[model samples]
Target: MSANLQSAANPSLSLKKRILPVWNQLGMLIILVLLCVVLALFAPYFTETNNILNILKQSSITAILAAGMTMVILTGGIDLSVGATLALAGVISVMLSNAGVPAGIAMLTGAAVGYTAGAVNGYFTAVAKLPSFVVTLGSMTYLRGIAFVISGGLPVVLQDKLFIFFGSGSLFGIPTPIYIMAVVYIAMFFVLKYTLFGRHVYAIGGNEEAARLTGIKVERTLIHVYSISGLMAGIAGVVMAGRVISGQPNAGISFELDAIAAVILGGTSFVGGVGRIQGTIIGVLIMAVLGNGLTLLDVDYYWQLIVKGLVIVIAVLLDKLRN
Candidate 1:
């Protein structure tokens, strides 16, 4: 029948063939590979193995933060304070380590600090019904100030060699940070694709009222979501501290820009309720590749900042068009 044939030809007839988000990610994948190719051909030393390692190492911190950003953005909410949280956790962890705490416990303490900060954000955002932007924006400044006060405007040098290993060491010839990044992605991918909690996240983002009417416990879920974001920030701060072998209160300034940019580029909607970890990881790589490629071409850091800002604006424009 003609009707049947047309129906079969329509990709939307099957969930697997419907081509919005998935196909978009495919396009991103192609662009990422092409970027690597072009950079390799034109950029000096870019294709070298050691330089490749360096790129990954440099990208690790951004990737880690982007993972958390992905979750917050999925809910049509944002966390501006994550970068500040990084400083707070990093300084606290290092200060503890220097004062004779074990590396593992010190790291846990840092993560807990992040979690607590996230909880505060979530409590106000959900229970108090405040705008996430406002709450996190205020927290961002205060948290950074706290970091400065606690560290006395000095870097906290870490002597825990084991913690340092987490940042710079390798496992089976691969950077440890790479492994940490991979694990986060894998864990997030599994949660988003195969878990009820993940489905709830998507549902909440797509339509908060509808989800609430459907008995989703919107407030509780939001609290958990914000908490998760802080947890990821804390995790990132620990690795960053280890990488630098010191905790600098000034670390992570303007870092939120990169994380949010990566998420948006990866096909996540700012309007809430549509995105995937796969797209996010690809976006992360694209950002990293762009940064790396530009650096290889000897672009000035200020120019890079301009480029990054333009990328965010363009990505946002494209997102609006897509919607």
Candidate 2:
């Protein structure tokens, strides 16, 4: 029976070869489902419709932020200022609403503020040739400082109903934030899949010098990428203001960490240009489910932080192995 044993051992090895590709492609999705299943088993009401909706609603902000982060990461850059930009934008939007500006105009103005901030970041990185990390790190500090200065260190309460609807209201019984999340993902997916800009982003991430040599406007593209990231942060700020019904300077603290974690967990390369929008959303869902499940299990918030950090480390390790 030695011959039979040898054949059986070979089959197992063959099976591994067969399974690796699927695991690489659907690993995050599989992890998400397993997490859901385990939580359902151990956490009471974890599978309830209301709880599921709550998870989606809570994840919407992170999902929105991760969408922009995907582009930035694909280009082999990072934006540490998005969280600060969110806080500043939220504060501005709320202040404008309090000043009796139309909700639409105020929201747009807040987004514009984010765009300007991102453009400045891009300029420093592209034109000044400073590292993205350094530029955004500086931007993060100054932007938060400005938010506090303008608001005089006080929260601006949002009173506009229309503004609140974007955060709190539902359509066809689905949360409005969920709808916004869907739209952002859909648009991002289209842009990354079909547009020339998307190709350029990938090219840059793959090899910046080569892309430039091939006639890509590397400088212009970087500016646009960072600006998009800022705009998303700005939009997220408005949503947060609506949810909390106030603009707090302290809002979105450490949000950048979560976005980066989600992006990495979704299988995006930390180095850049090696991931998809689809994977990022799955990563976002995995994080949301993990957090929600932990809360339901009465896990301490501090422990949850530890767990999240560990998850990020593991994800990076897996990414390295895959690459």
Candidate 3:
């Protein structure tokens, strides 16, 4: 009788503990909802379905990049070159398509180029013992220069009708880009939760030396994590290019900052080894909401930048307090 009572009581305690961490994930969502409510009250147009879909569509690329960034950060590393890689990938894909290559082939080539860029970052950081921060930061500038040089600082356009569908098509009244984001997130969640690689990532972030001692193949894992980040940035570029029907050489400038902010706001620690995909999703939504709300309120663009910076600082402070 006592054992049965104890077992019943344990469920409630376990539930509470589980619920506590979830509150952080919920924080972004609550703020998003409140922002929407306030915006709708002030701007009647904010309640429109078109406006809502526009916000989701605009956020699609950032969400995709952030999803991969969440994984990279989990391994105690950062990829500052994502934005530059994104621009390069988009420019390359568009150039290929314009040069008589099939749209599909061009897209694949872009993804490959992006993956290669990631591999370079991984090699230097993992094998050469360089800090990821420094390696990616250097690559960020180099890659952006490459993008401009290759495209001659001009935009490239693809006239293929089918290729544009990936950006503009809708399924069951939802944008295709939004659907793509959903698929990516679902796959990422599984990879993070179920794979040996995922376990190794968390282990490495928790303690690289300890993980190495445990034979977790720390170098290889780090390489893979960064490669994934670059690949995802490439994917984002492709989607963005499709949406705009043109690849701008300077597209995705400063996009890495937004992605990193989203990851941190999702409760991922800069110190690493702690994060959740669910939280990332909420963080992405929060960013989308903030941007949308500001636009609806007619807030100055410069002020919006200030607000965003403040939000990131506050999020980091909160994360530090939690730790």
Cα lDDT listed for each candidate: 0.88, 0.92, 0.87
Model 2 has an lDDT value of 0.92
Give a tens-digit lDDT track for model 2, residues 247-312: 999998999989998998888888887889999999999999999999999999999999999988
lDDT (Cα, tens digit) per residue for candidate 3, span 1-323? 87667757899866766776776658667777887888889988988999989889999999999998998888888899999999999889888888888989988888888888999999999999999999999999999999999888888886776567777778789889999899999999999899998889889988999999999999899889889898999988888888999888798988888888898888887778888887887788888888888888899999999988887787778678656
Candidate 1: global Cα-lDDT? 0.88
Candidate number that wins on lDDT, 2 or 3: 2
**Residue runs of model 1 more than 4 Å from their true location after superposition:** 1-23
Candidate 2 Cα outliers beyond 4 Å, as residue runs: 1-18
lDDT of 1 at 9: 89
Q: Please report, as a residue range, the 10-residue window in candidate 3 with the lowest summed lDDT.
A: 16-25
Candidates 1 and 2 compared: the better one by lDDT is 2
Better of 1 and 3 by TM-score: 1
| lDDT of candidate 1 over 19-128, digit per residue (tens) | 65466668778888999999989996888898888878788888888888888888889999999999999999999999999999999999999989999999999899
Ranking by TM-score: 2, 1, 3
